[model samples]
Target chain A: MATVEYRNITKRFESFEVMRDLSLSIADGEFAVLLGASGCGKTTLLRMTAGLETVTAGDLLIDGLRVNEVPPRDRDIAMVFQNYALYPTMTVAENIAFSLEIRRVPKAERRRRAEEAAALVGLGEHLARYPRELSGGQRQRVAMARAMVREAKVFLFDEPLSNLDAKLRAQMRFEIRQLHDRLGTTTIYVTHDQIEAMTMADKIVLMRGGTIEQVGTPDELYDRPVSRFAADFIGSPAMNFVEGTVEANGNAPAFVAEGIHLALPVSLTVAPGSPVVCGIRPPDLVLNADGSIEGRLVLAEKTGPDVQLHLSVAGQDFIATASRDAAVEAGGLVRLSVAPDKLHLFDPQSGRRL
Target chain B: MTVHSASRRRLRIVAAWSVVALFVFPLYYWITTAFKNARDIFDQPPSVWAFDPTLKNFEEVFGISLGFLRQQEVLPGGGNFYMAPRLWDSIVVAFGSTVLSVTLATLAAYALSRFPFRGRHAFVAWVLSTRMMPPVAVAIPLFFIYKDVGLLDTYAGVILIHAVMNLPLAVLLMKSFFDDVPKEIDESAIIDGASRWLIFRRVVLPMAKGGIAATAVLCFIFSWTEFVFVLTLTQTGLKTVPVVSSSFVTSTGTAWGNMAALGVAAMVPAFVFILLVQKQLVRGLTLGSLKQ
Candidate 1:
């Protein structure tokens, strides 16, 4: 296992910069995820680490050695691509044994190691099958076996579960995490799905516009997002934002919007009339008859054990989740309450958290 | 519903067979002329049937005197009608040139498919443009070059010219085949600690086997049927079937029977090559349409 470091890395394609001055440090045996939307350059960063794409500016260190000019072969990293990228012409056994073969391991040893890796991925019976003969999830397992056989310094995954069906994707996600836990290899996984990041990442590096917005543990990002983007991006049903001006009512601070008034914490030091965006997560918003804010319920969706309500509060849309037994209906009036400590305040002008 | 569809399919089959028959008529007439004697070949209204078959034309073409064969007067070119050696020459040149061209084209096409260099599109276009020039335009200049290099009338000379003539088409065909292979395989191989050459040989090349076989067949056929370069470059030392067939057109009259005999014999090697790779040829043509 190795630690990965990106120091001021920048990538540009003829002045159109995809990644700009990005830096990150992945600890040894850490499963760090690069999470973002499409075109957010998470895949580019992963590729740069794999030497598939050049860093364009800064140094990339693997195990504390600068690997800026090292080719992928010499870098000693194995990647599982989004398409699985299994060799179509090769059998599953050959595909797993390929890296060992290239390293000049003996034929008997190669076959032994291939079988071991295949069994690790539950593919022992499919050693002779070609990639096209397998289902999408099976192909993904073959890709995992190929990477596992390498026993490389780092394992890179570029949306490895994207092609599988939803149920399969969830199943494979747990399997991948278990494999990572067992192997303890430094892995950098790039994915747009926040659930994958939240569930699998030891450290989630939330990215937007080619730069890291926040890099923290899953709980850290969920409980304390540093910006409005992170707050909205990291949770199910997303975080709710209500725009209002902060007012100092003597020693107490209150947020006043069009038709909502919510009390802020006393320690929040903001100008009396400055505009701020108050963020509250969906689950933190409770329906209470004695609440300070009222909204019209637009819709209610029952998903499993929780019910999600889409509401329009203070001229802004918000989503709040309650228990399945909560009495909620579309087009009904509801009073929502958020604890003062659970409120996240950001500047209305810059979107940075205060 | 089944009956309507079955009748439509039957009508389609009839139309397809009619078109096939229209295309095969010339080859049918030519093969039949190979078995016809000079008298029947010159008969008015061209005997389609009821002509007496003779082995005399085959005997003359192959220089083999079967006990039942009727011998004819030897032609004026000192029995050059013995075309077995010429047939051998055609096979050697066509096979040699196909091997040469396919090897070179595969390497060049792989580079074109993978590496992104400046002017790569223009380079491919230029390679294709080389095929647009008429062979006659190049034949004279190549004749002098071959003469200076002491390569005239040599098998090597003819093979080299034919390989060069087929290179553009071979490269274009091979490039499309290489393009069908995903680039991820190459990157994966590299990450698997394989060198670039190893990836090409062990990964990409094997995946492209069907395509290469298809390309080789096309190159072999083009080299087999090529006329101008072989005619202008070779003399008595060597001649392919296409050029040697011209020698049958003499001062007195054209030996249509002898020419037809040579033409029929030449089709066998090419036909055999195509048959060997017919499965791969069909599959290779329709590749890249489906994701694996």
Candidate 2:
């Protein structure tokens, strides 16, 4: 319901600078996910948004109001921490109703609002239970309920589902998206899991070394990553990269490395003799009889619908996702081809996309 | 091999029980001495078990039976044996100082746990160091201060010194307890719109009730048994049990029966206090110093 904007924010811990003059804006009602690996300053950004951490320089604005000095309570934001910081001594209803109780809400109204929030998170039957009596997923929902009960202008989640198991994490991701859809609260969720960002974010902000690498839609990040790091970080089974130098082969450019030769798109404008790293997603490489790249099969791991094919081409390890029904065998010869558009070429020196 | 291990286990049990009995033997002898006559107390080689029990010690020490008091051949100033006032003094000083010290320590500890003042660690070390000096080393200096302020021999004077003496250990215990309650909980409460004071009183304090009880019981015991301060500072105005128990060693030969009676009676309140907090005590002793 409120816009959150960080303008030229810089965070330094003593002498070590963690974030450097980073600026980003989150639109009202947009689910903005800050995605990065550990030690990447993602959680620090979320904590600053919640007012738990002070900004070392520059301004933080919520709904266009400068709030760098505002206390957490006055900021009017609710946060769901990575550890689901529920009050261990309080019942589920009490934890959900705590913010209202702090504001001196009447008992009857607090109960009504608490029950309503609990029901929305499917925790109505757990109203009287303490946090210790709940499972990890249930505790997570209680935390979510606690945040939503306040109806705050901005919702901040710091890796909220990282503790849950895989199945539960997926389900909670769906439920969180549903809740965002229903409440339309401006949410800034920090997570290192690319899948969470891909499935849940309206805007994905990929970060590295405390700076924004790219800010785009999930499809844009996965399909059109701006750098080699983005291309490698966002996809499952990971994108495979082969080091080579591009050479002119008539109109097209051929990438040549030790015992490896592959073609680049005709439109690739990188100087034909320049060194570059060519990348391709696992799903983009398809099995074709007349494929240009050939390698000996290593391992075919079937994951229900698709098989993750691990192959050794020349001296490098490569992975491709093959259809489960495709005729494939371990240690057999495999040939795979990629569409020219699916190939991503990055500058070898700067790692920038070519 | 199994038989050898079983016999070894039996020997371990016997050794453990022997140590326990060694500790409990003195207490058993003292309790039985409270019920013995003057003659039985001085019996040849001392009576371990067989003794004709009598209530004369309790009756005389507590002034329980007026008819019995009338039967005794007494000196004109016979108030020396009446120790009910000294028992009352011990209870008042112990309870008073425990309440005072625990209140101050809890407030100081919460601030220590949450605030980031410069040299905060050094400040805590300084607080604890106050208790490191020998009690006798401070007793005489304290006596002069109490006398100069006209507080000597008063309940307020003794209560103040005892509370000051116990504050160091009390603060250390309470501060550690506060540290054990995760700071994340406080941050969460703050985000929930509760002020620091509200979060402390409503959230942190209730969670640390077990630790506070443990600290209060320790303070109560220290105040109850403190000797040199009461002995050095007070005279006719007041006397607690530990110092007053020495009065039974007058030149007219020790009144072993009456002294044993007073010792047994004075231990009840402290024993009852320990029993009341026993559950919390166990948990508090292992409090978050170790990972769960």
Candidate 3:
């Protein structure tokens, strides 16, 4: 229900800084996700927004009002922690109503709001049960319900679904997305899982080593990552990077590595002798009988829907994902081709996309 | 059915029983001795069980004189002369000391646990070192100071000494207990619009009930049976149960019967104190460290 802005925010623990000169704005009602690996300051940024942590030097605005000195209780924000943090002693109903009780809402209204939120999280029957009695997924629902009942201006989720098993994580991911759509609250979620960021965020903020790397929509980041780090981090099986030199071949451009050459897209503008790293996503590399690039399959793994093949060209390793029906044997020679536009080129030294 | 397997099972059972007897025998001896008459205590082969049980020992203990006999009574240079029994006096001193010490120590422990302040670690180390010092070493200086302040033979003097003696242990134990509670629970309350004090009252304190109970029990045990300080500082009137029991041994005769009864009375509180906390003691001690 409110926009959040971080202007030149920095956090330090003693002499070591965790977040430095970080500035980003989340529009009102936007599902923005701060994505990064552990200790990359994503959760630190989220906690600062929730007023659970102090910003070393900056302005944190909620609804355009600075909240640097505001305590968490007065910040009018709700946070769902990774561990749920549901009061072990309280029943589901009490947990959900805790905020309302703190705000001194009437008992009847508290009960009504708690029931409504419980129904939203699909925990209507679990109102009387304590957190310990609930399953992991149910405990998570109770945590969600607790946040929902507050109806605060901002919703901060610090890797809320990371604690669940794979199946539960996927299911809760959908539920969270649906809940966001329904509530339309200005939410800032922090997670290290790029897949979660891709599936859930309207805008993703990629961070590395206490600074923002790139911020964009999921498709924008996947289609054109600004750096090698982004390209490598935002995909499953990760993007394959091959170090090579760009060479002009009869008006066409090609990347030349040791004992190997890959023809670049016709639109590539890199001059000859330019040191570059070419990135190819696993799924984009197709396995065809008449494909241009040939390599021996080093390993093949059948993972239900797709079979992943680890192919070696000369001395370099490459991964190719094919349909489950494809019959590929380890150590067998196979040709792999990728769409021209799907290839990403980066400057070797700086790692910036070229 | 196998010989090796049977012997192995027997060995395991014997080991378990040995552990049980190791802890249980001392308590059993104390309980049996509390009931024995004077003759049975010194029988050729000391009786394990009381042949003639009597409450006479208890009666004799309650009736015993506990006043200090002044060495220079009616001195040439005049001074007040007095001989008094201080059983009731010790009870007052111990109770007063335990309450005052534990209350202050608990508050100190809470602050050390919850807040981050300047020199917090150094302060904790300093308090812990105070406990490491032998009670006898501190008793010498404390005795002179209390005497100078006109606190000789006063209940307050003994109580104050006991409180200082027990405070460090109480503080250290409580700090560990408070640390065991997860900080996430506190943050959850904080984000819910509850103030810091409210969080402590409704969330932290309730969760720490078991811990506080455990600390109180430990503090009470230390304060109740402290003997050295009470013996040195208090010459008359203000005597603890341990100090009263010590008086029973003299050159004239050792009143084993009276001593045993008084010893049993002192042990009763310590026993009951542990029993009260025994429910939470196991959980509080482990604090779920064994759980994955």
- Top TM-score model: 1
lDDT by residue for model 2 (B1-292), tens: 6999999999999999999999999999999999898899999999989999877676667766535554543423574255544688999999999999999999999999999899999999999999999989988998889899999999999999999999999999999998988787788899999999999898788778888999999999999999999999898889998887887788878878888988899889999988887877665432221123
Report how far off residue B82 is in candidate 2 (Å): 6.2
The segments of candidate 3 whose C-alpha lies over 4 angstroms from its true place after superposition are B1-11, B64-96, B147-156, B284-292
lDDT (Cα, tens digit) per residue for candidate 3, span A115-180 = 999999999998998777788889888888899999999999999988889999999999999999
| Comparison by DockQ, 1 against 2, better one | 1
Better of 2 and 3 by lDDT: 2
Per-model RMSD to reference: 2.6, 3.1, 5.2
List DockQ for all candidates. 0.45, 0.41, 0.33
Candidate 3 CAPRI category: acceptable
TM score of chain A per candidate: 0.97, 0.98, 0.97
TM-score of model number 2: 0.92
lDDT of each: 0.89, 0.89, 0.83
lDDT score at residue A137, model 1, on the 0-100 scale: 84
